[model samples]
Target: MSKHFWQTVGLGTIAGFRSMTAPALLTGNLAKFHPQALAGSPLRYLQKPLVATGFKLLAGGELVGDKLPQTPNRIAPPVLLGRLLSGALVGATLYKINHGKTLNGALLGSAVAGLATFGSFWLRKKTTDESGLPSALVGGLEDILVLSSGLALSKGTDIGAPAGRAL
Candidate 1:
């Protein structure tokens, strides 16, 4: 489970940079090796229209302005990918926590999410000279906010309790 979470984080981070490549790589890898993991719980929710769209875009190679239509820049793809990856990691972490009767699983989950989001955001900042320092700092801070918020909402106030159970 830990290995899978880390792999997903790495893939999601890569996807964050080139929204099209990461999902295609992830879907293919999951379909090939981690097929069972994709079948249940929060991971199953990925069988949705938005994920399909992302898969299509990724498969179609829209990342490098190759073999795709010219569309204005937007943040939708990366954001959606981030959410999906985060949810999957959180779900898997919760499952392990419940199955093992553990209390620290959610914290681990949040750390993984933070690592992935910050890794991606940092990579983007370091690689792109177009965006100024202010944009990068603000964006990195936003990623941290999102990760913290998601962790709170999914893990709730107590780790031993069920996720969002108190809500």
Candidate 2:
């Protein structure tokens, strides 16, 4: 698979853990490094610094919320849908920027996001139970994983790959 494919998959995986994170990181990347990548495209807004900032703020909230006792389950229908959309958005953005089909990217991203949601949830639960770690601590660890991975995947678009040209 191409690096972009893996990057999209990684972003989808990040969405599974934290819904806003992948989009946030993607938007931030576009805003800072590839302003013309989405020119004349509906996804152009993603390149706006304001949009990137907004997503970043939302990502921050998600990070904190994930550790809260009152936060809802990530697999809940509504929340799950949000994660799916988040994955789709970033995937589409990356694919479009890379001259790939947006729908294909969306489908790949959504599918992985769904699978990762359940898989990660189970793993988080198991880790907490087996190690006697607080759920919050485990969630904090997940935040680290998602952020590091998301950032890398987002920046990976620049591996000498041409950004999507007004697609």
| Candidate topping lDDT | 2
Q: Estimate the TM-score for candidate 1.
A: 0.37
Q: TM-scores of all models? A: 0.37, 0.90
lDDT of 1 by residue, 1-167 (tens): 54434433444443333344444443333333332333454555433555646675653544344212353222446554454454344434344423432224333433444455456556545645565655445444544543444344323223222232221
Off by over 4 Å in 1: 33-56, 59-62, 65-167
| Candidate 1, lDDT over the whole model | 0.42
User: What clash count goes with each model?
Assistant: 0, 1
Q: Quote the lDDT for 112 in model 1.
A: 48
List, residue by residue over 26-86, the lDDT tens digit for candidate 2: 8777776664556788998888889989999999999998888988888889989999998
- In model 1, the clashing pairs are none
What do the candidate models score in CA lDDT, each in turn? 0.42, 0.82
Query: What is the Cα root-mean-square deviation between model 1 and the actual structure?
Result: 11.8
